[model samples]
Target chain A: MNALAARRRHPAAIAILLLLGLVAVGGAYSLLAPKQAQASVVSAGDINTGKSLFLANCATCHGMNAQGSAAGPTLVGVGAASVDFQVGTGRMPLAAPNVQAQRQDTSQFTQEQIANMAAWVASLAPGPAIPGAQYTSGQNADVAQGGEIFRINCAQCHNYAGSGGALSRGKYAPSLTGSSGKTIYEAMLTGPQSMPVFSDSNISAQNKNNIIAYLKTTQTEQQVGGMTLGNLGPVSEGMFIWIFGLGLMLGCAFWLGQKAA
Target chain B: MTDLDTTGQPSTDVVHLDEGHHIGTGGLPARFEDPGLPTHIHRMADDSPDAGRRAERQVVALFGLSMLATLVFIVAYFAIDKSVGIFLPGIGSTNALNVVLGVTMGISLFGIGAGAVHWAKTLMPDTEVVEERHPQASDAATRSAAVGIILGGGEQAQLGRRPMIKYALGGALGLFALPFVVQVAGSLGNPTKALAGLRSNLWDIAPGVSPIRLMRDPEMTPIKASDVTIGSVFHVMPETLKDSQHVLEDKGKAAVILMRLDPNQFSAAAGGQRAQAWGYQGIIAYSKICTHVGCPVGLYEQQTHHLLCPCHQSTYDATNNMEVIFGPAKRALPQLKITVDDAGYLVAPEGFHEPVGPSFWER
Candidate 1:
């Protein structure tokens, strides 16, 4: 005990004790802590390629380390789904800085290039991943249930028919008319700009597929009634009636007022 | 009559009426010679018997067409299947039954109208008649007589003779409206009581009672802190709401929007700091009711941390203590002080400090 007490006063003793404690805690944590769920297995070579691609193409605005700069937000934990949504949808490599990034018909990068970039971003931290094909396919999904979920959660901004709507400032919820099922899944998973994230826990994969199915059904569904009047509900219908219907009435009245030939 | 020149000067020429002409009381001619209607032009049917017979046949044909259209309408109603769709050139795809029924009905109504109008123009009397219009107002004596009769009736009832009866009747008639006024006012209930109800919600915990757990809206499942990830939003309601008698009413004031954001994202200002301190880790909850016009502010932009009310476009900065960043909302959205319970489920230890939703006079 006297020998240990003498050694305890040594300057290196405290450092040794702290090191031992750290190792013990780290070892225990590694052994007992729950493992983070990874969406897919990615190789180190893919990650390296992704880093190189990011550094070459995105480093100007996102910084060399992916830390945010004055012009762009930090992409450290934004995840692979975010990259897929932004790059896959051609919203990134922004044409120019504006209120919001617009979706383009053709993406700047190919699918393989986007995957490499997503892998690199995913390596930085844990986040949402690109959803599986089963969940995004919208095959055999319950359209009715999906419709109910959509009405309660997404109808406010996306419109009842997914026609899109205006937001504050210059922002807007883009129309979902021709969006791919994969793009829709990623957008919901990542909650890209001006959109709230509906996490996997909030809306299960099955339900998300259901929502996709409902969207697809609506896009393909034929309008049973005559003219939809732009599907703007009562406002456009009212305007059409006022301009065309009333004009027809006025024309008939004028014809009646004329003397018979 | 005097003629005025274009140069703004009256001309010397003056025309006068004949001395034999008589003036009425109002300085108008007492009588004017009738100017007969313009010479009637004979129609083809009016000039020839064969043409008249042809006109009759045409009218009968229009009437017969109307009857045929009516019969077609009945047949289409029974024969056409409701589910069948047809492609129209301009209208696109439409229900076959609806189109057929509408067309038949329109034709049926148009035939009758056209047949009657054609008969009147070609076969009926073509001569025009003149009808004179009299003045609209009654003469002065007749109007005075009406007033006198009303006054005499009142006198017969002793309304004028007895001042007390006249005044009493007026008071009684005026007071008769009090019941209706009272009924309307009473139906509105007490404003103070209603305000008190609005001020508190299901989150309110009495002393010694356990805090209320935040449950998922619609699903009513309790949420653990770990389930909430950064950038995720949850629609929440107090667990106590499930057992309440007035579920919808309580839900209106108690509905909350729970969101998880990075801790570093919160502003360093006092409001932001307070918001952070009141939250659990990076998760924060706020009343979903907009401080504008009581709309459910559900449009949450995860990147911008902006909560937008679908109505009125009221935008609230979620990272800045729910401050009003834009729109007509006068105040910030009230934050709900949330913390996890023993089970790690999110709970509200206390209720909102102020009322939720749009401001009222009492607030």
Candidate 2:
């Protein structure tokens, strides 16, 4: 009876052992593999097309090899993500260099052309890749968590309400109320202009989603207790109340006194 | 009362005052007319006994409603679950407790005001009397007369004689003033506790125990010295902060900005020696909070090594021990002394030597 029971359990135990072995082998392979092997797959955009696009649009400032010149900084390691964000948002191919680069309404290159140029620049050296389209989708966004994260990280430059505020010199954090999800996410990933880069390790994909959700909610929500007064905060609100609201009331009181007499 | 004619001329409405002639200016006409107030109209409650009684009952009912509303406010303060919400027609969902408290409090105040106003308009004295203006300073006889009138007025109002009114007014006034005092006293917590809270943050290094490792802000990952490249900045916090209950409060005081700068860039005159001794391989950490008003000093101009506070435009020179370069800051940001452990993780051997953040720490 004991021999029969042992033989029956042997097959089940062997199957479990085989599964564990397979997992261990896969884990080992992933750990031991070189980083370049994985990176090559992501950087496989057509080199010829990328080079031509870069030369036509970006070579005037970025140089023939996408290297640094007197006009602009090197695009060598800025990556496909940076190129997509800059050119895609019309912030690059800058309209005459000033204190800061401003976002324009029209893009000089098509989305495909921008991608090809970004690929060429990224081919020089491995860097951050373009985030997926679903990265900014409000599907799994958590507004409460996003609000907390935004307050911790972005509220310093962007106002609490995302109305944006002044930075050093002439540069300012642009308002997010009218910004699309792609613009907000791309801005965070790329840093663009004076803004600091928030890496995947720093914010994570889920955190970015949360921030986008929070921004959307803030944009949609109505300001309670009447006027927002430009959302510049209490100083402006106080001035309006004292100068306009109180002044009107005082004028009415004077008129009533004159009528009574 | 002044009445105008069809031709817009002043008529019987203009009445001359006897006192105006004596008070006339030397060069001007010795005549002046008194502009009297509008004629008084009697309310129904003032003339009819039944209407007066009805108005008195209505005032009592309003006061009763006010008392009931005050009871509701008191109950709502403690009994209601603050997080719950209620839905109403035409209006979206809102905090139930807030609505209840606000409505009850408003009605309580409004009832008192409305009751007092209604009493004055309908039941109180209706006759209109005018008094001539007099000089501010009074003679001895006039002062005595004023005191006598005041005493006589108190008797006429029957407030002094009515024990019920004296007790009711005393209770009402006394209770009405308590909420203000309670609000003030409750808001002001223990001063010593608050001061002590401000004195030290979450980074506590006990002797013989290992120092707290530096972790990245928000991410809370331990950082290695090799990770910091020259001209790069990392917003840092103490590793122990990960398990802290008061993460925000401690983070505010303990937040540090870690940066790696070239050793050659350090000027000899401005705390160069001290900075070199404290830092490990040109990597130094300073409190990110501004010395002016405790805003996060995040903006770093890499070329100038200047940390600027956008709130008030206060700037600090990071190259020379974070000296105040421009704007309102009175002192430098507090520096955190750090070193790498055996595992290559950056750790603080001890907490900040001085309290971090605003100039209030100096106190």
Q: Estimate the TM-score for candidate 1.
A: 0.73
User: Residues A115-206, candidate 1, lDDT per residue (tens digit)?
Assistant: 89999999999888888789898898999988977876788789888988888778999989889888999998988888888887887789
DockQ of 2: 0.04
Residue B337 in model 2: shift from native, Å?
A: 2.3
Per residue, candidate 1 scores C-alpha lDDT tens digits across B148-190 of: 9999999899886789988888999999999999999999989
Which portions of model 2 show Cα errors greater than 4 Å? A1-50, A221-230, A239-244, A254-261, B1-130, B133-199, B224-234, B242-249, B259-283, B299-305, B360-363
| The best candidate in terms of lDDT | 1
Q: What are the candidates' interface root-mean-square deviations?
A: 3.1, 6.4
Q: Every model's DockQ, to 2 decimals? A: 0.26, 0.04
RMSD of 1: 23.3
lDDT of candidate 1 at residue B357, scale 0 to 100 = 86
